[model samples]
Target chain A: MSLEVKELFKKYGDKVVVDNVSFSMPGPGVYALLGTNGAGKTTSIRMILGMLEKDGGSVTWEGKPLNFDTCNIGYLAEERGLYPKYSLMDQLRYFGELRGVDRKTVDERIKYWAERLAVEEYIYQKKGKKQQSPDQLSKGNQQKIQFLIAMISDPQLLVLDEPFSGLDPVNTDLLKGLVREQIAAGKYIIMSSHQMEAVEEFCTDITILHRSKVVVSGNLNEIKKASGRVNLRLKVEHDISSFIRDAGVELITEKEYEYVLKVTGDDQANGLLKSLIAAGIPIVKFDLSELSLHEIFVNAVGDEAKEVQE
Target chain B: MNDAENIYSIRGIEKVFLFTVRQTFKNRGYLLSFILFVLVFTLMGPIQYASSQAGRGAAEKSMSKDVEISDVENVFVCDQTGILDESVSDLGSVDGNVSFVSDESVVSDSLGKNDIVIVIKTNETGFIINGIISDSSDISNDTLDVVTSELQSIFDDTRMKKSGISESDIELIYSGVSVDDPVKESDLYVNKDGGKGKENKIQSGSYGLYMLGFAMVVFIVISMSSSYIITSVTEEKQSKLVETLLVSVRPMALLMGKVVGMMSYVVLVIICGAIGSTLSSYLMERFLGIDKSNYGGSSYDFSIFTSFGIVNTLFLVLSILLAFLLFGMVSGLFGSTCNKTEDIQVATGNVMTVAMVGYFSAMVIGFMDNDTVNLLAALIPPFSFFTAPVAFLGGRISGVILAVAYVIQLVVIVIVLRVSAKVYRLLLLNGNTVPGIKSVLESVKGA
Candidate 1:
């Protein structure tokens, strides 16, 4: 089944919030929505989920309007919340029931997720001990509960906004593993986050929004391949500043014996390496790779800004 | 989306309702309030009865002291029922010449202007005690009343003792007398205008009082339930759970669930209160020896139910339900516009204002004694919910008018729900700022 979003638009008075933002998941995989702060990423997600009214848009699942009736969706919102006074178990059950999951199934899912997310202590009560409320647990644990709620119904499509914003290293790894499980299980997922490494690790396609407009969109590998392997990390025992200048490669940064340079393509990098060898510069390490997702995002935003300036 | 989708979107309301109710019962504040309400209502009747009994005893003692200081020179007791002897004359602190006469004629002939003849006679129903004074007696009416009150208190104690009955069992013995059956004043008044005289009908003054009382109760119940609705609705925004919830269920469904959920809690509390009050009343009669029969010979008329029968009562019940739903939905609408818990008081105040207008209008129009204004008030919404039931009971409006008022209220509730559903859906996601009227209106228009 395909999930398609087309010509999504939203505005408030004279301010355009999300302008013609559009993307689709043609198959089961992770599609990333990346943007700067106040970049309307959350707003676009809300419109897609039908939580907010769009000025213009259409979101469909398998050629039907995407709603609860047509699609079983799980959403972990950016502004995370659980009822502070309610029990974690009760809140999960309530959310599960709302998604039309039966009680027995919801209970089984809760038990599974609580263990997988390592939040079983907060959910299950001990002898003579009160059940834990959302407020009583740590923020990370509460987030785990929210994630558990999102997955309680075993939805076909899941949308996560800032899923790893405030997690520690351990919890982050745990969540990432569960996300991999979902991918392996062949579920359609839309993720929005500012963490470039996580996005790069999981996302096959992406749309980068800036100022409520898309600055970059398409397959991740193709976008990187188009930019070519232009990043060169070279380390030599001696200073080769003048030799790097002779090779005509743009030097980006330099430390004691290491040089980070920008090259036009693989030929330029090979030429630099040959020149360094000819100069008797002992190369301790020589690495050439394409731009990372972080660099690509920064360059895309910078280019968009330049175009707007022009 | 189509209308069918919008209408069918409330599929998950049952889950919301159950969760809300369960959580509410689990909440400490609500549970405490419920327990306190039940406790207070359960103790209400016994407390009032005990206080009134104490007050009556103190009043009797004070009046007996006043009688002791009065100028009456003689109290002649002619006991014909044989329940009292000459020692009964010493029961009061009269400080006058006390005499026991063998015949009533002897006391009548010997009675002077400063003397009162206490003659006790047996009757088919009970004993009758007469306090007779000379026609030219110089005693004031206040003095005579005090003396007679003292005598009555003394005789009551003596009669109970003579019958070997305890003070607590007096109410049971007097229960044989059918004084508690309420009788309508209209039934006793002769209809001089061939039964068509409105004046000969139930008095407007009493009806006004009844309507005022009924309106206060309805106002209280609606205000309380509406406050709960408002609080529940605002909680979603405050907790930042609206987005997650909206994905699972529609906005209308969420509002409906919370409203109905809180309402169910309120109804439970009300039922508990009723049970407590009934229990209190029963305990007051059974254990405290305090029954309505002891409150002199005055009759209370529950003529509202008796005069109208079951049909009008059902109409009244339906009107109240519709009114409650209307106000509850309005509360939800206003509450959705709020984004903070602090704004709940303001929302509650707005609801109370609407409720007060209905209550005060019913109270004011109920006393106007104008048929046109009464009929109009009984047919209009808000006011009709408060006034129509009582107006029908008072015979100020006919059953047909009451039915019309019911229909009007139902239509109003439907319209309010429609508008509220749209407003609720629009405003649930409105962030931290509380939206003003213009924004709400705009949202409604867009919806």
Candidate 2:
């Protein structure tokens, strides 16, 4: 099944919050919605989910108008919360029921997710005993419960906004495993997060929003490839600052026996390597890597700001 | 994956409705408030009855002391006609404390110490009778007339005896002379036109029912259901859960689910209150023998509820239920618009003020019994919710008027619900304070 969002637009008064935000995933995969604070990522997601009214454009799933009634979808909002005074089990069941999940199935899914997410101790209650409320659980555990609720329906289309914002490393990995599992199961997913490494780990296609506008978008690898390989890492027994300077390559960093250099392409890296080898530098390691998603995000957002300033 | 494969089965609104009701009952504060209200309402009738009874008893005691009808018994008579002794002795039914003086010279002296003195003297026409009473005696005119009638009867008897007439003839003449079918005096306050006028006085028990009904509306519609709706909506909004839930259910469905669910909770509370109070009051009167009448010193006729016909009772129940639904939906809108807990309070507080106006106006007009005011209050949308029942119960308005008022209320509620659905959608994702009144008004206008 395909999920297509075309030219979505939203505005608050005269200030546009999401403008011409467009993308599509023809098959099950992770699509990342990346942006800075107030960058309209959340607004775009809301519009896509039909939670917020779109000023312009349409979102369709499998050639039909995308809506709650038309499609089964799950959403994890960035500002995470639960009924703090209510039982975790109850809230989960309620969320499931809202998504049209039957009670028996919801209960089974609750048990499954609780065990999978390692929150069984907090969720299950003894017979004739009062269940624990959300307030009784820690913040991280509450987030686990929130995740459990979001995934309880086994939705085909899952939208997560900052799904791991306040999670610890172990819990984050636990959630990440479930997300990967869903992807493997051929479930269409869209994730928005500030963690670039996490997005890069799973997301294949991405749209980066900056100041309510799309700055960089399309295939993750293609965007990086177009930006080019700009960095090289070298570790040697001796300091290579002079050889790097001789090669006319800009040294990005030098600490102890390691050197990081900026280069234009493979030719410049090969020329630097030749200069280094001829100089009889005992090179322990030489590695050339493309710009990280973090660098690419910062550069794209920064370049947009510069353009605006100009 | 095919489109059908992506579809997940969802439970109907029954699940949400059940969950909401269970949660409300689970809330200790709501439970406590409900119980407290029931006990208070149950005891209201007995307490009011006792106080009125006490007042009635005290009034009867004071009334007996205020009138001195027995004081006129100390009357003295001087009969110089010589036939008065026989004539007066023949009148066996005269209850006056009359004593004859052997000496006429002592009669005037007797008047100073006694209440009054009467002298009967034989004359050519018939007999001359004169009465002397002290100005300070304070005898009422009715008491004086009684004494005068007895003396005149004695004179007529004396004349009839001299004319050889019998007592039977006198009885026949007097019996026929009396006016038949005397017109009873009535005040202007009475229902002079015999129209469907307001009952000038309602039975105490009926008044109590009116009060109970009014309080029920206030508690269910304003206090309990509104607060529940607002809190539930705001809680979902705060947690940002509404967005996710919206994707699973339509905005209208979600809103209606929440509202209908909370309304069920409210109706349960009201029913519990009604049952608890009724059961407690019954047990108190039946087993405990606490004597509800003793507590409520005055005697009351049957309860107003008892007098109501099936249709009236049905109307009462339906109107209140509709009114509550309307209130729940409107309050849901308020909660949806708010961004924080305090904002919910402020927003609902405005609604409460408006509801309070209707509540108090119903009460004031209920007692005033002014036709214009009652009609106006009963026909208004929400105020009609309170006043129409009261007017119907008190006989101030007809059934047709009440039905029309309910129709108006239904129309207003339908309109509000439609507008609220739109507002609910607009404000669900909005995290900012939705510019309260103006924003909703504008949205409604746009719709």
Candidate 3:
């Protein structure tokens, strides 16, 4: 069973928001939807989830039209919220109920997630004292609650849209661990984020949107390989700026004795390494790898105006 | 089994319903308002009642005082024609305090102490009786009427005896007669030809029910339900919680559940207010001797059902239910288009205006009892709900008209639900304000 969104399209009057957007998730894994602001990543995801009316396209799960009735879908929206004046447990229970979980199950799930998300204190609160509303909790703690709501249903498919927004590193890592566990349990996840490093760490497949169009998409490694292995990082005890220059490689950055160079191919990188050794500079670290997800994203969607004009 | 297969279940609807109602009461602002309402009505009932009783009591007391004063005052009778010579001896039979006087001076002197003077003179065909008393005295007109009527009856009897009229004939002439009415005004006309035992008399309790019912709808729909629905929807929209919610529940299910939930909360409030007011009035009357039945403006009698009849009572209940549903759903539609809490009023302002128009129009027409206004108001969707009760109670509308109005509302509700579903689907996921009805309609059509 897989999720397939084909030829999806959306528009507002003459302004097209998502044009012919297509992607497929063959099985349980994270599919990263990477894009700059207003690239229609959210719009496409909404259409795929059947939350929005599409201009044209079909979204299917296992060869049948996909809908809330056909598959259990958990969504962590870009703009997260809990009723500011309500208890955290109440809202979580409500969300669970929406997903067809009974009260007993909802209560159980709330307890489990509250403990896992480390929000048990807020949920249980003090017996006599008034329970805290969402607004009373710290921004990070609220984000944790939001995550707990999305996972309370234990859905088979999860869509996280900027799930880790506005979180400190510790909280981010905490949520990331939970997300990794879901994937291990065979949850099909579609994630959209500005944090490319996080995407690179989790997403096996990716679709990079640039101005309502897919500029790059496919297996993450394949897309990175397509971007080419033209970037190199090196560290040495002595200065290697002169060797990099003589080897005809473009010096991108230098800090003390360390240097980053851009190369056309492996030949240039090898020559640079050889020149550095010939110069009697002790090679501390040498690495040749494909483009980082960040670099690839920048390359794909960097020139927004140019891409739109094209 | 996938989650989607069981998504159409009632468990979600039930949860949302319970959550919303609990939240409404749990909200301190709402709870305070409800408490204030109960106190005001409960106290108002007995206070108004007591004042009315006091006024009636004062009038009754004044009447008894005048009777007592009249009983003590001496009645000086001056007989000029001598037709009352025999009757003068028995004047005490007429009133124990009366005395016959032949001198005019005695009659004139008795006026100083608010005493009465009666002079009898012969007219061409009968006796003339004149009564004189102090103008400033607090004498009741009832005493004077009884005195004049009694003298006239005596003169008639004396003349008949002198004319040799038969006693049976005199008895026949003075006997009281009355005609029994078989057809009531309401049964004849308001029932529209459904004669015999089909009277739609507006009982005393019906008015109280109408007043209570109208106030409940206005308060619940305008102040509580509309605000609650608008705020809830706006909050969800602004916070984008709806995006996740829609995945599990349909827009219709979510909205209608809220409508029912908020309505139940309002009903609970109304019931509480009624019980509280009743209990307060009872406690006041029982413990404090307030005599609420005499003082209370309208008795809090539950006999409205027996008075209004089963069919009419059903109409009343249905009208209220339909009104709440129509207004509640309208508020929901408007609420969905809003993107922020502050924008809620702006989004639902026109809808509220429409509701308020119906409410105020009903209030005016309720007292006016205008057939045209009542019929028109009853035909309009929401206005029909508010005005039908007034029209029915005022006898401005017939049974047929009432039924028609109810049917119109039912039809309007179905259509509104359909259109609302479209608007809800579009606006729930929309990131920006819908701006106006034109765009919303366009979106609904497009969807």
Which residue runs of candidate 2 sit more than 4 Å off their true CA positions? A126-132, A303-310, B1-12, B41-220, B277-306, B367-375, B389-404, B434-439, B442-447
lDDT of each residue in A160-253, candidate 2, tens digit only:
8888878899989988999999999999999998888988999999998998889898999998888788789989998777778877899877
Instruction: Please report the candidate that would top TM-score against the real structure.
Output: 1
Tens-place lDDT digits, model 1, residues A179-289? 999999999999988788998899999998999999899999999999999999999899998988988999999999899999999999999899888878799999999
- Model 2 residue A100 CA deviation (Å) reads 1.6
lDDT of 1: 0.80
Q: Which 10-residue window of candidate 3 chain A scores lowest in summed lDDT?
A: A301-310
RMSD of 3: 6.2
lDDT tens per residue, model 2, B1-447: 112212222235566677777777788987787677677667665666566667878998775454434556556677786666543442233454767775555756545533666677777787777777766666765555557667778777767777787878867766754322221212112452464754443433344446445644654456767877888888888877776676666566666777787777666666776677567668777986755544431332223343466766676677677777777777878888788888877878867876787777765666566779878988987788777876766666787888898889889987877776566777766677562565577555543
Q: How do the candidates score on chain B by TM-score?
A: 0.72, 0.61, 0.65
**B1-447: candidate 3 lDDT, tens digit per residue:** 121222223335676788888888888988897788778767776667666667778998885554443353566677676655444433323454667788657657546544666677887897788776676644455665556556556667777867788899889888786322222324434443454555454433344355445634653555567878878878778776888787878777888888899888777776787788779878886888765445532433333333456776676667777888888887888888777666776767766777777766665655555557667877876667777765675465777887788778888998888887666867877767563365467766666
Docking class of 2: acceptable
Total clashes, candidate 3? 3
Among these predictions, the greatest lDDT belongs to 1
Given candidate 2, what's the lDDT at residue A49?
80
Q: Which portions of model 1 show Cα errors greater than 4 Å?
A: A303-310, B1-8, B58-62, B69-181, B184-193, B196-202, B286-289, B293-307, B435-439
* TM-score for each model: 0.83, 0.76, 0.81
* lDDT of every predicted structure (CA atoms): 0.80, 0.73, 0.74
